[model samples]
Target: MSLPTLHDLHRPLGSTGLTVSPLGLGTVKLGRDQGVKYPNGFTIPDDQQALQLLAQARELGINLIDTAPAYGRSEERLGPLLRGQRHEWVIVSKVGEEFDNGQSRFDFSAAHTRLSVERSLKRLETDCIELVLVHSDGNDLHILEHEDVYATLERLKQEGKIRGFGFSGKTAAGGVKALEQGDCAMVTYNLNEQGERPVLDYAADHGKAILVKKALASGHVCLSPGVDPVRASFELLFAHPGVSSAIVGTINPVHLAHNVATVAQVLKQR
Candidate 1:
């Protein structure tokens, strides 16, 4: 079968007016290798390798890139690597979670949110972030209600610092809440887990965007013990019209190409 390219998988990001490829490049592996949940351990790639991967992603026609402050030096590294090619990518970053000394902490106050965004701006070397998600600590409701992060994101959007904002949440209800008030939500959904189906439904019905995090169960899926994991995972994910993209963090250029090919096959089948 002739495979489709990443450009063929491009879709609109809800009402945000941003277009994204169905396969977004996640950069966690590019920065932090400690305290991760990956099935296998890997080394953080050097600048040369990182640049090659970024270039491969663009060549594959990917446009959305996901990163966060809690992802160690992810934003920092992206700053210089993505400098000259900034216009070709839609950058998605987050705030409210900080990783320090191998420990994680949360701070969602408006002041901290502003500071965090400023730091991200400096680290990403971009004047305005295309999308910003609230990096939730799994306490989705409490953070959505009690914290000032969402309000702060709205203020940033108005100030032209961020074009749009949403939540990288842990619960279906939280995703619903965020979309009802914000621009998008990043949820987890794969063969091993389907609890966030309601969130996808909400997005489809409401014309809001939903990005799938852990769409491959963080590389833990083994459906039926025979299926190609990547193909199976994406077949289910892209089957949904609401999913704008799935963020897969891999430093291997070959693996990245395989993923884009699999997503293309799934789209062709659809």
Candidate 2:
């Protein structure tokens, strides 16, 4: 594909000065199978392919790559691939979840947070991560208010271990709390769920980046029998003025091409 135009690829993610394609890419399964079949599906990036996809993203004008500590080997895979080329884009990682027995589980203890951040930095091969978010779950909304955790994170920021902070979760309340209690610069959620409107709106109004997680709903729409509806949904979300970016992950090169093209169409219509 030719270089993607900012018209189709660009958005200012709040006050971070981290401009990126409104349609960002998330590497949730860069090293594992995500259990969904694509008409032209997504692919988990091998070590070599991770670099290639990132390079391709840059060429295509994408500058945000979302990953999390619970994403298994994704950060480790991205570390080497993105090493010296980190400046080419903004990297987002989460630290509230851990992979245990091949499943994802949450841990919000201050000690766990420190370990998670340290491991994430090592795997991402960065002394300082561009953005680190607390991966939130619905229960225990108080988790975001952990003074010990936020204070530790603030100290890390002061020490230059992280540039910014944020949270990724399923609700507006949790995200809002995170934004208020910490140095949060970004918040992520699934637009299809429509459960975090207030959180995203707050982030948008307050100049914090809002990144949509399941813009594709795990391919529920993309592979649905109704092609027009799928396309319509994509346009509907992309056209939202509040959404700074959407991480629509895919493996098939052609499908990824289709996503970028759809964003172009959405931009044209706007």
Candidate 3:
């Protein structure tokens, strides 16, 4: 029998009028290799390799693609790679953080936020991004309550440059606060970390989308020998009804397929 794919498991991304696959293809490895926290080092995929991976992802029924300015050349490469298939995916990009010269910097000023979104649009070759998130610098509460980034994102949504806006935050309080004014919150949820469980709970109760980042603990899952880490991770994530999708960044086609199959099995069991 053929393995199940995510195509059949698409669901609503909160009330944003967008439906997303349970697994989102994260494209960081397509653009940058330095400063990443993956357990294993990997060479950035070439144009042909990247194209094939993207094609395989679509065939496996993934519709959400996550990218960010912090991910080096990810946004720019995706522009040409996804040229004609724009409507086929739900694009999630971010503002506030920028990676340059092998270092990271953040800008949450109103002017910088607007500039970042426009630059991402040009780089991604899209007129409007589906979701734009404020990439936090670990100071989630300050960014949400003090910075102009969230408010700027709200304006961008109204101006039709983005369909929805939210926060990729580090704390549960920040996640809940972000959802109070946004459509989604990308939080760290996996077998190793459950501190953000309250964020998932808030999303479930308030009708907000929760996208799981580091779903496999950034490739450092240290579980029991016989316990399948990927399976265990998805089991934890999908058990929560508020999780819209888990963003997994894998450049290897084999890993991608395995992840999809594992998630399919877990969702079926659920």
Among these predicted structures, which one has the highest lDDT? 3
- TM-score ranking, best first: 3, 1, 2
> Which sections of candidate 1 miss by over 4 Å?
1-4
lDDT of 3 by residue, 14-50 (tens): 9999999999999999889999998889999999999
Per-residue lDDT over 1-270 for candidate 2, one digit per residue giving the tens place of the 0 to 100 score: 563444445877666666778777788768556433444455566666666777666666778888887776788888878867887767888877777556768777778878988998899887888778777665536666553566667677778888877767666787777666554434334335676778767776677777777677667654356456446766767655667788876655666667776777777668
Pick the TM-score winner: 3
- lDDT by candidate, in order shown: 0.92, 0.69, 0.94
Candidate 3 vs. true structure, TM-score: 0.99
Which 10-residue span in candidate 1 carries the lowest summed lDDT?
A: 1-10
Tell me the number of clashing residue pairs for each predicted model.
0, 4, 0
* Residues forming the 10-long window of minimal summed lDDT in candidate 3: 1-10
List residue ranges in candidate 3 displaced over 4 A: none
For model 1, which pairs clash?
none
TM-score of each: 0.97, 0.85, 0.99
